[model samples]
Target: MRDGPAPGASAPTQTDMDLDLAPSPPRVEDLIAARRAKRQAILAKYSNGTSSTSTPVASQSSQAPLPALLIAEQSITRANSVAMSVDGTPAPEKYSQGERRASMSNSPPPLSAQDTAGDIGADLDKLDAADNLAFELAKGDEQDGMQAPDQETISKLEGGHDQISAADYDPSRDRREDEHKRLLGEVPHKPKVEDVMEIEEIEDVEEEDVDDMFAVAMGEPSKKTKKVKKTVSKPAPVLITTTALLDTAADAEGYYSVILGEQIDGGRYQVVSSLGKGMFANVVRGLVLQSPPEAEGILGAEVGKEVAIKIVRSQESMYRAGLKEAQILQKIRQADPDDKKHLVRLERTFEHRGHLCLVFESMSMNLRDVVKRFGKDVGLNISAVRTYAHQLFLALSLLKKLNIMHADIKPDNILVNERKNLLKLCDLGSASDASENDITPYLVSRFYRAPEIILGVPYDPALDIWSVGCTLYELYTGKILFPGRSNNQMLLLMMELKGRFNTKMIKKAKFQDAYFDEMGGFESVERDKVTGADVIRKIHLAKPTRDLRARLMPPTSVKMNDNEAKLLTSFIDLLDKCLALDPSRRITPREALSHPFIRG
Candidate 1:
């Protein structure tokens, strides 16, 4: 009688809404499981590679050593500043700026941390003691020179393109390992342009970098007028207003998608030089047909044009997630009305093969190459410093207010439009949002990391000021502020230059224990935990602050004349605050931007 229960009677149910249902159709379950599997595969494909995801953990007791000196020489290329002359011909360049001569001011060399350099007397001893005791002990015997490596081991090392087997280990090896590495993947793969002796088309190129790089750099009135060429077509009509364009594209989270490389406008475009390559993509210089072809998504206005193409290197469809980011960025054109002056404008975006191509207004050159080639032009002089620093400050001020930090600010990231006397920041690959939660980034290039970032402390936009300081230093002094060998090496240099940080700043960092233990090395260790304010202690960097005082050396000013052993000093001053370990106490971008040295 209960089996059929009353037809319309309510069925008894468990209090908490317990219920039972008929088994699902196997086909439906299979379809759902298949969809889920597909979704998981897509997710796995878009995930970031292990390359930079984890915080680097070093063993406390280990002292691994760097491979033998793999120093690569810089190439001296005389590429044209203007892609084409007004008459529609490729422009030719001659000398680069640093190769030019300049008058300088003289000052006694500041007290150096090391008394000796070239001789490698105490320095080599220190380098020997620094780390990698195993390599050091074997490489330098009592006489200081290690024995030559045997040929069999060399053959073993060179013969295999893969990892060296354990048996190949021989303390007897000297130059063999280095030669093997050089033969493998190291630079100097291409020699310095000067080493070529003779160039194919250009005649009698110089060995050293010259003061005036482009033909127009020479003071004499050139018979030829600067021809503004109109070869590259105007960028697409889409508008973008951010002072920074690529910030939205770079992922701080461990998420990455492959770039799909599709030929823009079918095969009508021809590939040229390579701009750069990332693990996931290849940025190449390309020329597209100016005329329209019967194609979909081809913006009629940009039918024939030259542009930089960034194509993802992977073959998987999951790269669509990364392309989605590019697509979103491509449509963006809005910028704060007031901040437009500081923002770089986006021209057009088109899709090819699944990959997206973004077009931007071409620039003459980045500040790094300029400084490498034309630093003398910026001068060790006060007026030149004012002009260059002023422009940089203007750019920083505008960028800071937008809550966008140029995380990868470096000489290489700054682009100069010589004709306009304007500087635009480029390379958003490492840029990040200000509101992001995971703040400790190893993202900035090796040489430009701020002290806080280096120490694994929570970082903010102030890191940019540190880079600006580094840039300012390089601009005036023609030297790198912290050309460290590794992340630890960089922090060591900062500690050596600016002293140790106090407790609070130390506490905020990811690895405070190791750093805290080392604080005893400083002169003033009161035995208290380091605070944010204590980042800079009594130990100070070599200085001639404010006016030239003893020698009238001012921040950002060239102190001595060339005949007097020229010195650029003010930049050294910025390094003090720029290197300050506390984020709260560190100079803000606006404050650094308004500093007298950068002010005209």
Candidate 2:
């Protein structure tokens, strides 16, 4: 029944029609108020136990909007129920929505209608509580400028999933909160210096007590804490000296300062007195605290024994020379085990304060002291000379047998007993093997130097015999027979007594040009009286001015009897053979030992 009567009013526009058909949009405030009202109504229903149970599941699902808080509460309640089951039964497998709906349609209800209504009511109560908690939390988060906890966190909390327990406590979250609080000036700042001092103090306390604690725990007696004090040792004071004599002070030059009464060598030897000093070493008499095994039961060797300790200068050259001397002495000791050869015995060798020290048997005095005490520039008795000469020949024979050269031989180098009967050759510091070619030309003292040494001729054990000849003459006469102040004077004096060098000897001499001209005349170096400068001049001497035989005779102050004259003649003959100008014709130690002067 339509009378389609439209007129005048502008035909309804398309927009006006659409607007009339559309429903009015709800305001945000109205929606929020409605939600709150619904929540309160649900909460009141659950609290009064008067919620409508007549509502079917389908009507509830279709008509009522699903709220986030209600969904979360249902999920959490189901999870809690499954977790709290004590039957040890497996939980039902989860199903997709379609599968759940289909199953619900086909299967019988797992619960009674009343029980399902009660569960729904309980779930609504949980939802209300969760919604309140969320609202409060969100309000706090907004004030703090932080995001509120998400849906998952709310679910976990409603399920009572270990809230605030170690499993749920986040150390990182706490750290972040602490950092935020510190940035907001909620915590006081600590000073770096105070922190460092506190840490150091703790470490010191631990160090002082850790050992004691460990000891006590191990059932050991606890030790008292000891405060360690560091000590620094000051160097010995330096001594200054102006004379040529060496100082006892330690120096950078490697000289060990000898302190009197100081014990050295591990307290085995105590220095008693300084015996003597030389350019290369210092000789000190030491009291042996413990006698060496080798010295036991020997007549002159015993405990509390006195030994001459020769401490070599710390210089490298002197140390090496001292080492060589020790080796040679060891060889000598091995060669003559019976100690019959009249050579000084090396007791031992050791190092003390960086200096090589050699210990030897202490002798009463040297031959120089003998000459000074008994001979006194005149001469020793013929009987005494005969005894000493016999012993001297034995020592030379031993040296020749061993192929060793006593490069230094003088009265000062020979040692004797207090009675002057026992004699031993000592001071082999300059001695070398006979095969050594690098021998020093200025080895022997100038007064006792052999003629071949002055001529620079290659020498052998015979050179030692020449030195022995010169030494014997000095011992017998208590005077240096050929006392030359320099090498030039030494050669001149030798030529004056022995004779001019023969052509054959001069041709082989290494230093012949220095003492002789090309024409074979003596070129002597003499001091000028006016200038005190050396001047070389040629001298022609056909023969020796003084005979060695005459030189060996007793001094004019002494008179010889018949027996003395015969002994003197034999002694002169021995001297002549030893003092031969030509080393090749010189009498050897073995030959000299059998001479009438030594054997008879």
Candidate 3:
């Protein structure tokens, strides 16, 4: 009967039979087809709001569904396709059950026995290759340490999401509703390409991004490691109110000297010593590299001998004044190069940095220094004052002929040549064209400010004569003749010393009300609002008892003899003429030169 059953095998076992008769494992195509069918059924049910009692597996498979392994593979392939085509074409439209069933049934029959085994192995290899490629890409991203969001992540950022209930989808719920309504044929919303790409492209931000964000939020400076921007602040303007912008010019000890032995003016001159400093300019003694004919007389034929360089600041008002002063010097130099008796000789003018530079012939010292050395005890000798005064008047006479007004004449403005016992007027910064009628009221030193200037009357060169008279009184007595604390007090001092202003002159003054009553006498001095001091009452009560003659006399230690008295009388007469209260009657420089006091 079958050559008898093998001696060991009695009958065919159920286990063996079951194993051999089991249907072949589902093929890759079968699994894919089954999954697609399942998805289509779900979509169809959702779209039409209908459902089948049949399970997805029952509808997709004729006999039985594949094992878990095959299901997993099907899920993976479907996921990849969905991700790849997120913004691509929509999936094939849902069809009738009959058509779907036909499609499911039409999947090619299982590969032939040999081919099926070979394909399965090849597919395993392909899956492995795909897995390796994916792993490699993921590894590369890890190595870089900075990863851009994938399409799905960016879609979430941009409020792209799957279908969900309004309550569940909080991010961009309005946008979701809008999209939903568009799909429902309520409105046509054509998204722009830029709108779609906006969030996805914002990826490659580094340290610079952090800095830019910080800058936008707060005006914070960036890290030192990065490039930095530099900003510069300008100096504020000084509020100047005083007549003498330079308070230090009167005190020779107040000089702030420059560094000695410093090269300047393109190395043509070297610093010798500091001469002095003022609010608007710095004067330094310099040595010339090449001695010109003009410099030879002042500094000798020796090269590298002393000269004076006045460096004026670049403030607008001060700069224009400096340039104007230089122009005046240029005019004087053109007019008289050989006369050292008049104005200080300007050797040349140049520019240094933002300052105006004036080179001048060096002098031993200024008249103020000489006055300081004489002290208040003995005071300056009459001979010295007479010599300096004569030189000053000669200069004034020349200036008058030139139609120039030396608006500021003070002790410090006069320079002395000790070697020759000669004097010259310097610092023509306040000199003006005789035609400049609109000159500022605050021009000269307060100690020497003219009566016309104080009362704001129309003034001319006669203002210089008043200033000279005041300066000469100080030179002789080692004290200011008026020395009022303020302009109002100064007018009172003028009245107290030289008597009241002429009623006509007072009427002609622009600032008459400031100093005089309607009756043309001294106004009751009012208290300073800021200082709370009775200014006018103090001035009225503080009138000096000593006349100009008594003030100019020497101390008891230095006796005044007959010769001194005669000299003093001539000096007093000259002073009285120079100190005339009336501008029309004030002594002219031409007239002052011929007086016995100066002529002697």
Candidate 4:
């Protein structure tokens, strides 16, 4: 120092001290030796279990002093006998990070020779006691199975006053246990209603379906729900009557009844009686168990009321046919604002046991029943015909506008409401979209079949007019106008009434050869020549020359006045236009509606 600082004077600045006592930079070997020494010192301290810091790594400066600690703990132990001599014990073992973590896990404490005899003896006694207790519990289980526990044994148990034998216990124990279980769960495990069903299966039921079902069963009022039941995981089961189970089989005639008092549509409807049967469906009279709000005041307010349920045959083809009929009926409702005025109302549609079921307003009877009720031979009065004809025309007009055809326009398919004196065109299963050039020849009942269909000619809705003429003739004369037993017979009957089909009409017929020759005349039949054996022969037949007026007008008890007779003539004239042999000359539905017979 140039001039040492005086005692008790200010300390030297950090920069001044660094410059005055600064040594030469250490060699690489010395630097490494210093670092190793520091690491060894830290390892010794930590391995000795004497470090304040719990972490394995500590300060470098603290470890730099003990370089021997880096050689090996065992070598250091041999070098530093003083450390062992002081304690007469080796330093605690050093552990790596992985070893340390492993040692912290739940492993049993290791046995040591240092364990006292008394501690070992105590552990043995504890094991023996556990073994004895387990054996006694097993004995008790066997004894319990063999015989009921005595009262003395029950009273001897802990809290004996509170315990009771099962024989002496109250029946209310089950109720208490169930309530306790229910309280512990999110929802009651047992069904709240004994009759609860899968929610998905009974979609028509309201959200409060359970409540309503219970209410009805208990003879209480129903509760309404505003919210719709869209999804449910474990909805309550619904109660249904078992009346229909036994009578669900078809009889010899393939007609079966949906038993009276049987519930359907989740108990919304109850079967009252069998209505009738069709080729592909069964009609039943049903009473609505509960009125739906949407259906109220529509179709004579049929909700919670009586209706006709047509359950189609379970076969896929029949079911699909029924669905088509339902679709057509729905289309009619959508197309016409005054649908209910002329067409039979389709109240609802649903599936029941794989069959398509259609619900419709219950009608008193059909036109066939009316014809049967009024002696067919004597025929119904002209007034009755006019009343029904007007409503039928309204229906036909609607169909014409939609370009749809009632392929099977028969008396059985026409329903009448006797109460209102109204007629509804029903059974649209045979109805189809009309096509001018694609008309199907297989159409209508034999008695009401148009001549064009019989001759296999492409026809339009004018075919329906021909059906109306036949229907009216039957209604007026109480006899089928063309009561032909077979197709050829029917054609012959038509020929007698309206003469033969023209050359062009015959040419267009696909099955022309079936009924006619190349000359556009009736094909000759095969007859027996010799040995009474049948032989093919081209036999000639006479052309038809029947009197329409004399055949249609027969003696009837229902007398007619001058005005009535005039109306009758107009009626016959309408039939003439409708029953024309040529489709082009046939009366249209629209034109028929304006005829004096229909309007009058």
Top lDDT model: 2
TM-score of 3: 0.54
Model 2 lDDT tens row, 360-462: 9888887777766655644565656766777777777778777899877777788976445668999888788899844244656666778777777888888
Candidate numbers sorted by TM-score from highest down: 2, 4, 3, 1
How many collisions between residues are there in candidate 4? Answer: 12
Candidate 1 C-alpha lDDT tens digits along 212-271? 232333233422222211121122233222121232232332122323342444565556
lDDT scores of the candidates, listed in order: 0.41, 0.60, 0.56, 0.55
Of 1 and 3, the candidate ranking higher by TM-score: 3
**Predicted candidate 3 versus true structure: per-residue lDDT over 1-600, tens digit per residue:** 112223454453542221111121233335447655655554333223312222334343543322322432343344333322111343343344454344334222221223322333344344433422210101122122111223244335435521111112122222223323322333111223333211111123335446331222223333222221111212223233222234222223222335678776677788887776654577998887765555456533367667889977555566688889999998987766545336888877776555677888788776566656542422355665676677788778778767898876877788866322466788887788888865234557666778887677888889899989987876665555665545565676666557656678878887776555444445444445675644232122222333555444433345445665677778888998988888899998867776788766
- Candidate 2 deviant stretches above 4 angstroms: 1-255, 292-301, 554-559
Worst 10 residues of 2 by lDDT: 134-143
| C-alpha TM-score for every candidate | 0.46, 0.57, 0.54, 0.54
Q: Model 1 lDDT vs. the true structure?
A: 0.41
- The runs of at least 3 residues in candidate 3 whose Cα sits more than 4 Å from the true structure, single-residue gaps closed, are 1-259, 291-302, 524-532, 535-546, 553-561
- Which whole-number lDDT from 0 to 100 does residue 291 have in model 1? 39
Q: Residue 508's C-alpha lDDT in candidate 2?
A: 80
Candidate with maximal TM-score: 2
Task: Return the TM-score for candidate 2, rounded to 2 decimals.
Answer: 0.57
